[model samples]
Target: MAALRAACYVPRVFTPDAVLIERGAEETPMARRCRERLPDVPFTVVEDRQAARVAIGDDFAAAKRRLVLAEHRGSFLGHCPAGTRGLRCCNYLMMNFATNCPMDCGYCFLQEYLAENLPLTAYVNPGAALAEVARVLDKHGDRRFRIGTGELADSLALDPLTDLSADIVPFFAARSNALLELKTKTDAIDGLVALDPKDRVVVSWSLAPEAAVALAERGTTPIAARLAAARRVAAAGYKVGIHFDPMIEHAGWEEGYRDLVATLAAALPAARVAWVSMGALRFSSGLRRAVRARFPGSPLLTGEQVRSADGKWRDFQPLRVAMYRLVRRYVEEALPDVPLFLCMETPEVWQRVFGAAPLGEQALGARLAAR
Candidate 1:
């Protein structure tokens, strides 16, 4: 359980250019932590979240560096939007404590999804999210809710500044009906290990090859460091998950993935890994424009993708299936007993890989949510 870089490990800190606080959010716990932690950053109080967005002036990607603490008055927990009409949805759920990630991964959908939502926002009122979760779990007492907070933000990236997870981890640890999944591409687990999840939490990491990471995933933890952090978390008595999502079909991609899987298999023991999921690279045509404008040299734009039934451009079905089967084969050979699943994929693709698809998204979600 020794860390590869623990002695010299410095948490990848995210220091925003300025912190904008929405009027009533000033006294919120999240705002207080940011003020206390980021004493050097200038602070401004805005009338509302939209006003804070107007205060920050930068391109879409660069705008992410500005932190906006505001109140989210709407519902917090909802079904993941990744499920498309024809796809076999994982029945995943998402809770956004924050609205956007500080890291600028080239393929991040927020570039298009949140085109108007400029600044990275941390909803100062987390009690609302916890309350929403309690209500859902109360109603669905017969079911286990596997809720993830990373769909709209890097779950752990803002941990140092917001301390949101400290409150969330213990909350989920106390519940039997909820399984909180903290997914991230950062090695920011210092606050995590100090807590005991009691097996009600999963610390998951989304990974790509080291070279792919070096190119497009900016300001994130290296894959090696992520795996090392996973080991440490697993040793600390928490089950970890792996996501090889948005798997890019870059040149020499086969070799890249082969080596990447080997490294992951070596670091992640089967028993410690709760689940491993994969999704081929796919994005809306609008996001393609965003990626080109932001990262002109990104290799993600080089794939032979075609629009799928979901209306997003994805690798052609045949090629996508081939890549999944190959990676599935690699994982089967390496981590023989771990549960593997596909994310946001068609039933045809699911049938081709696993010989069958779930009865429906709810059935799939029920199966994965089981303790």
Candidate 2:
């Protein structure tokens, strides 16, 4: 977690040349960090979020190249793990501290979730929003909540610029009923590691094989580097979470995944890992054409897919189960007793993999809360 050759050293990723600052966000800490990171990047004060959008342009892909610092007038905290029918929900709370990610993965749902052409926006007033989160936690004192910041964006992709972890990690550390999970794909952990929050903070990484990383997940840290960073985080006294969600299928996939699991196990021991989650690639119908167009020849789009009851296109049941089982086997071999869960999967799939499932969403939430 020490500073590297350069502060902002992510290769082949977008570093904003221009920052569109909304009126209310100009003096906030998040905006100040952005300005400090890119000292030469020109800043234009816009009247509102819509005007900030105007400053970017009409092309969604093009707009991602710029950064927009705006006041998030909307709620920052919400029900965790937004559920779809037929899939069991985890009930983890979702924290929307940012809107979009700088990394351009082929299967990123935000490409279709956020408004096209809108520049990535980080809420400058997280302190206030976190106050609201505290109020909610205080109201439900008897219940435990696991909240994460990666639902809408890679939590730490822009952390070097935003320094959000310094604010969020400490906030969650003081709360007894909540655990703040900063889920990301980048190695930008220097600022986070420096803070050294207590055990309530979970540093998580989204993982895939080298082939899948090279083919689809562009502009993120390689799997080896990510595991290295996770080791550093664990050494810094924070629990780590690993995710293999959106596991893609391709030739030589088994060997590639086995190597990945082995590498992770070598990097960190089971006691440091809070949980591991396996999820197969699934997307909405609208994203099918988007992924194909954005990442031409992506194997993600070439899989056998069917419209599930939830209305999203999923890989065939047997195919998904096979992918999950393979990953589960490798992961269990590495860290047998570490808690492993399936993300957004059906009860039948759960039974097939784990032999038993949580009784309900509340039960799942309680189990994860204990972790």
Candidate 3:
């Protein structure tokens, strides 16, 4: 009898009306408990008792059924700009699979980004979005593509309940031309453990110093646990990736980051890595206010930041460059040949740090494909 994890009881945070709960035919002790607890909540009990009983252990069952909801058919994917809004635009694609996160990070942009107060909006139908992606790829077949699901949500946080990776992994596996990166802050990899570990699917995790994780990132899996999961996925033959985005500058920053990079190098060899990206903290004005309201104690929102041309607040240029340079040095020392990139940075910043302009997603995709 597995325990049931209720996502959120807050109406504004996670509208119960939007959630569709489907119970397995032969209800496990856990399911029975949930049914008893929320008798009024709408749910359909599976009639095929034998199959439902067996599916209780199947992690993908919930995610597979959730796909039946066809509400998000027309609107779910888009592009974001680089540097300033009117400046260079990075050809990035965002797959709006789900919204909000179960894990509460004080610095999360979702607090302001979401139109509704509800933290979770699971787009039940991914097939529709996939069809659109296929169309995009067919139209742009010659161009290499880099798209990620982590933009709108923690790609794999609810994976245990949704099994989205099981469906998404095979989709990308069939499409050799496009690269799909699943970035997460959790250790939920059971759904991906059995998938064919190919270059088409890059499993990535957001990393921060242990102190930061302890102080600000609430409900997220520990750094050690996340790295262990990454190690397991890499061992299973997948190209693993990491992001040190929103890198916080606190006391003993160098020692903290060095320890983090060292742990990563020890856990997985450089050969299994596809790429790693570094990004300093950047947030929209609305998002910064949300963070301050939700987490008044968080020091992340207290740093000296300025609004960039893109209308988002970020660390000053010199401080940002220093952070990037330090992380680049660490990666080069730890994994000499592994590819490194910067996220949402300016060409000037790129030239100063890496001696080259940041490559567009297509070129970045090509570079990864070539590797």
Candidate 4:
């Protein structure tokens, strides 16, 4: 029965080639779970992250196929990097329990950001990370904050092994000042649906057209599967967040997005949706090179993009604003009650799309946190 149960729980979302446990992490809850659940995968212990990287080699693509459970040094929390001086930022706080995602989304910025730390890693000490979060939330008790776990990695991608959500969910469920947003492109929510969030958590999915999913997002859950998983999550009492982020401009974008909105409306209950967001693809030179080398045939590279004030390449103001407006209209018409926002956009683009810009990130953060 023990063997049968372990076999039944083998992860269907991803199968790592190897499991690397960092020094002193071999006895961690996350490492123990990986040992039991990933029975067939090779497991090894290294001196530290550097040694693990050497063992994993320098190939970023190959490194992504391995899992590393290591100690997370330094502060685990920070502001979202996309909130640049010129962009009308959402004051989104980020707490990273992991540094890289296993999914190889061709256009992901982490391909460039995590070039230094190559392997897909989950921190072993989630308790310390949670304690840090509690301190921050308690210190800033007056103002509301929206904290997310998906900034550095897909929030739930390695959850089956790490069981990070099982710990973080109940922790946030007890907090009153902030909302925990678990964002991901995968349908790895088995650890999530079992937890009770007490309206304190939001499980957000990055919704994209199947064309873009096929073109750029490799190894992610299908749109249908993601929606079905989200429906299951909502049925368990957690609010849902929909993100049409990096909304790739493709051949039939308008029609594709319209279909996406219609499908999302039919599948997800509107009452369970807390927010909706859409942003056009924004690229940096580093990310562009990564995408070119990794996904040479990608249609994401075909768009005529210009460098924005934030030093990232994006569709010109008018083009992205139009994309936002159209997608916003579709979502609003379909699920009018849900609050919709833009991700990593400028004040001018916000103004163009909504007729007004948020007073600032603080005001926007407070508004979203209230929901």
Candidate 5:
């Protein structure tokens, strides 16, 4: 790990000059690890976690980019894909190990979900939360629980300093009824690769074309580097997954995605892959203004988008179906047997794209668990 960090010149945004710790959380392993990363930084122990909001001040968007660490004193587990109703949900559980990404993509919902100017926080006590998860799993050992640690944060963005994956991977490896899916955009797989192989753990990546990544998803690993890391992990006996989520309708989008599918197919081991997911670029109507405000020249906002029945903005149904079909065709050619599912889309759209839909959320959950 030392040699890997020395060789990689990745600029870390989670390094804070001053860290605010919730009084009781100051002595945890996560906090100690954080303090070690910024050795000379000042530590302010606060009685309440919300009291640190003063440091956030008036401009939250601006403060979010700065290096400020906060110890979260809340539960780390959260409800994911299940919260959005009337759709084919995978019943995925969100492990809120961390919050607020260091990499600021233009379309991130963190802008709305997190308090403005809240420093990037890592919940130190996921052990307590995992105990609760264990209780639930203990009762339903026959059922599969697909939990992920990337809904609110890129699972590996702060891994070099925190070494969170080191603990997380092994914990999931011991569990038979659950799978820990570490979804990330960065190629921070060094710590992950060093660990023993865990068949129950899925290291997944959020992918886009090189062009779209540069335009919207900033401060992420290059597409080529990501695939290289995926290949390395697959060779190490881990089931890799890919997410073509937020599939942007950028210029030359069709050609770009087609080439991306070909690249992934040629480079990745299809048999070791768990599954692939697709979701078109969709957000709340209010988020359009925020996205525009954050990225003034971003072309993503200029593309065709409409408010669907779900009261969120998305490309027209036909255009979205067309994009999915094009990408699916290319991807299926490469990963012939891999399960290709949609994220947060209606059953009608599912039937249109895949010719069928899951009977219910539980049914979809069981299907993904089998994978």
Candidate 6:
């Protein structure tokens, strides 16, 4: 399969009246071009250089670097329960990064959520954010905590360009209690292949049916490739997870999900899976217009959806229960030992399907820790 195409371009340039670079320091392909083209301006590289070359000509590389203006005020760590919408997610730590994503799924919330359409943005100050995270960790040393960057973007999509995972993985590994989850849809596992593969970090993927991917998702690695990556991670001794989030209720839904679960069971030992989450398709009313405008042909966006108590449009109770039950049965049949949890689902649905509400995050953490 062809890899997802990327577009490289600097989103902005900055001159902050601080941190001036010497003339000789700007010698690389990125820096030299920046100096000759925009002399006196401070800049940083942001988007995909290779994709930019294909889309905007080779000169796009020399275009000025994009710089995001940001500050680290207090605590860097952020938190969210499974129930919060991405918009309601108040955990904005130092953004130290900009938007960059090549995949264009029809249901992507980023299209409606972000101010700009740019899918890839590089924050030039991850080191500063790391320092802030350390400070917050030290200050709250007594408390057990969790934090992740996958909410706004795929955690490791630009890892090949930025080398962020290589740097961040070791840092999190050193902190015994804190956990980091790197969630993505791509099969870019090479960068993480050499890591210690301990339970401190979890590698998660958003999975869907092949029919759904062909119909709605674009520029994403196939389910087979993603499952293969998960198996590889498990072989390396890492705790792996799969999320059937936004699970679309399409034709042959039973067969589609059964095949997916069978594939996972065959690829890796079910006992190695840390956790599996199943969530039905849920969207905000605000995103309805955006979906119609951007992807009119997508059937997944045109379903009989109604607003839930949480102010998001979701499938009705019966349909949702059927989907969840089907998935739970297949997964349990394959890997009865692994914990299967529901994401953002209410207690009623939990009781009907799994016979219990999800335990608190602390208890879940303890259960996984014991494993």
Which is superior by lDDT, 1 or 5? 1
The Cα local distance difference test for each model comes to 0.83, 0.82, 0.69, 0.86, 0.77, 0.63
Instruction: Give one digit per residue, the lDDT tens place, for model 5 in 1-371.
Output: 33332333235334544667777877788778878877877777876656766665645455544343444455667778534757668888888777777677788877666745456776777677677678878998888999998987889888876788788788888888898888988878888888875598889999998778867776666788889989988887788989999999877889999999889988887888899999988878667777777678667778778887677788889999999998889888888989888998888998999887755778777777777
Winner on lDDT (1 vs 2): 1
Give me the runs in candidate 5 sitting further than 4 Å from their true place. 1-18, 40-44, 66-74, 115-117
Predict model 1's lDDT versus the native. Answer: 0.83
lDDT of candidate 6? 0.63
* C-alpha root-mean-square deviation, candidate 4: 4.5
User: In model 6, what lDDT does residue 114 have?
Assistant: 57
lDDT at position 72, candidate 1: 91
Off by over 4 Å in 1: 1-11
Candidate 1 deviates by what RMSD? 3.4
Q: Which ten residues in a row have the lowest lDDT in candidate 5?
A: 1-10
Candidate number with greatest TM-score? 4
- TM-score for predicted model 1 compared with the true structure: 0.94
Q: Pick out the ten consecutive residues of candidate 2 with the lowest summed lDDT.
A: 1-10
lDDT, candidate 3, residue 110?
69
Q: What TM-score against the true fold does each predicted structure earn?
A: 0.94, 0.94, 0.80, 0.95, 0.90, 0.77
Candidate 1 per-residue C-alpha lDDT over 259-358 given as tens digits, one digit per residue, 9 for 90 to 100: 9889988887888888889998888889999888887877887867898888889888888888889999998899887778898887888999888864
Q: Quick one: best lDDT, which candidate?
A: 4
> How large an RMSD does model 5 have?
4.0
In terms of lDDT, the poorest run of 10 residues in model 4 is 1-10
Model 4, residue 365: C-alpha shift (Å): 0.9
Better of 1 and 3 by lDDT: 1
Stretches of candidate 2 exceeding 4 Å from the true structure: 1-14
Ranking by lDDT: 4, 1, 2, 5, 3, 6
Q: lDDT of model 2 at residue 100?
A: 82
